[model samples]
Target: MEALQSVYIPGSRFLPTKRNMRMKAIDSEVQHSIRRIVNNRIKAMKAEEGNYDDLLGVMLESNIKESRAREEILNVLGDQNVDTDGLNQLKVVNMIFYEVLRLYPPFVGIARKADKDITFEGFSLPSGTQIALPIILLHYDEQLWGSDANKFKPERFSEGISKATKNQVIYFPFGWGPRICIGQNFALLEAKIALTMILQKFSFELSQSYVHAPHIVLSLQPQYGARLILHKLQ
Candidate 1:
């Protein structure tokens, strides 16, 4: 619970303060979804090939810098804690989440219905055939995203999601509106808090033994395993 940089919080300690609750409405659903993904994804990776240390690093950092904020919430959400600051400050966590999702889409493919009729590049499409939105097409789009679109670049999100997507539909790590990922806020909050803690304490990288193939079973996941190493902080 010690302060890492001696940077005191901006507000006073006496009044009944209110934390940012932007994602409060979607907390439950987001919690469930996050749990399923982390658990399943971790399990999918081979035992020796996975990086539990990365998670450890996050925990250490959270312990050192955040204390009361993330820890208390951790009690309620188990290991996950939804925090304020929205998703902007969550660049690193977002990267981890993106890497996880890109490697393992929760739904893989999207299903949609036609309103009437539609046309493609030069073909006429009918209105009845249920169409599938290939998530990978956008997730790995070289045109929309750059060549490293397939690579993990948390810096891309450092400025904002708009910059990452070039303000296009290429970045739907979460989904599009009306029925977009409802719990996105909650999940993101949790991811931010968790990742903030982790990054603050340790550094990490993929191990040489790690594989590149991601498979889709219930979600997109590593076919072999995800291996990474972490170094603890003072």
Candidate 2:
């Protein structure tokens, strides 16, 4: 854990220290292990046509059964290209995106510096004090999001962001206020369009080779990469 933490320390990779070299070696070994696991799973899948009742298998099965977002997309857009008007009508897709962002935010945290002396929640903060807000922690907070905070429930944003967050600043996947991400709308629109296109012509499932090891470098991502089995729709 210490070694892993050291890898993310600013300028650690640029240094010629022995500790950095050891960390790099450890990272390589970890990657090798992940590759082996993926290869073994692929071999197992190829060897048999039997049903997999593993945790991921069961979860995937459940997701397949429960998800109606694709159906909504098909109904809304049909075979036509996604447009701004059609995109606006995709309530379900938007909700799913919001839920996804809430669960797996692109950036794990946000950094800000205090411009002036101020008191927040009774604590006094001087100017130039750098603060790091862990967005994932707030995202999964049970107190703010109820008991199923960690669970994937897109319906939370069915009414809209204001209602879902009760107009609080707790939910800010793309940051909040004036300094919020300028490309937030464009990014979501682009994602919605791309996802709409994909769902229109393909059905996908998590491959048995998929390993759910999410880690953060600059952003939250699958440590070993996301492996999926895509089947084209008729």
Candidate 3:
């Protein structure tokens, strides 16, 4: 949501396109984010198992492992690897996930079909008309997020979803409704595992050349590549 806004909303100084372009921009971000999240999980799994097939291990083994599977779930443990801690330990990691969402929301807009004609903002929109919800605009709505909406802040979500969204239907990075992402659970779990491992292992800083420029093709990608420096941990 915030990420999509980074492209169109005024303060961000990004240009806007029609609704379809916005939707594509968001989907591209989502697909790229998912791949990186999965790969990171793979790396983390290897740290324990030496080899990891991830979900396959859970799906095929859960029936055999039963309730023990949750105990063995590393991603849920937050900062602690599954072997060292349990879901009770994952507060910080969850917070990080929320921040990632703020910085790189996966979708720009959501399209819906109107069941009946409706008057909106004073205009009569006919029935069967499609309504586009510009997630980018709602997310950066300062009235809802405060002036710091553009700034990266994980503490905003620390109070949880209601506080983060101001109890509105605005902050939908994975979308909403019955057709919402089925793999949301899998993707989130994977992201936590990967992000945790990366944080645990390194410290990073953006290079002098790094710039906050994004482009819209299918996804709002960094127009300039993400050039940064990572220092390995001892």
In lDDT terms, which candidate is top?
2
Ranking by lDDT: 2, 3, 1
Question: How would you encode candidate 3's per-residue C-alpha lDDT over 99-142 as one tens digit per residue?
Answer: 56655666767799878989989989898998888776777778
- Residue 43 lDDT in candidate 2: 52
Tens-digit lDDT track for model 2 on 90-112?
A: 98889889998999998989999
Residue-pair clashes per prediction, in order, are 3, 0, 1
How do all models score by TM-score?
0.52, 0.73, 0.58
Order the candidate numbers by TM-score, best to worst: 2, 3, 1
lDDT of 2: 0.82
In order, candidate lDDTs are: 0.59, 0.82, 0.62
Report how far off residue 213 is in candidate 3 (Å): 0.6
- Regions more than 4 Å wrong, model 2: 1-62, 65-67
State candidate 3's TM-score: 0.58
The best candidate by TM-score is 2
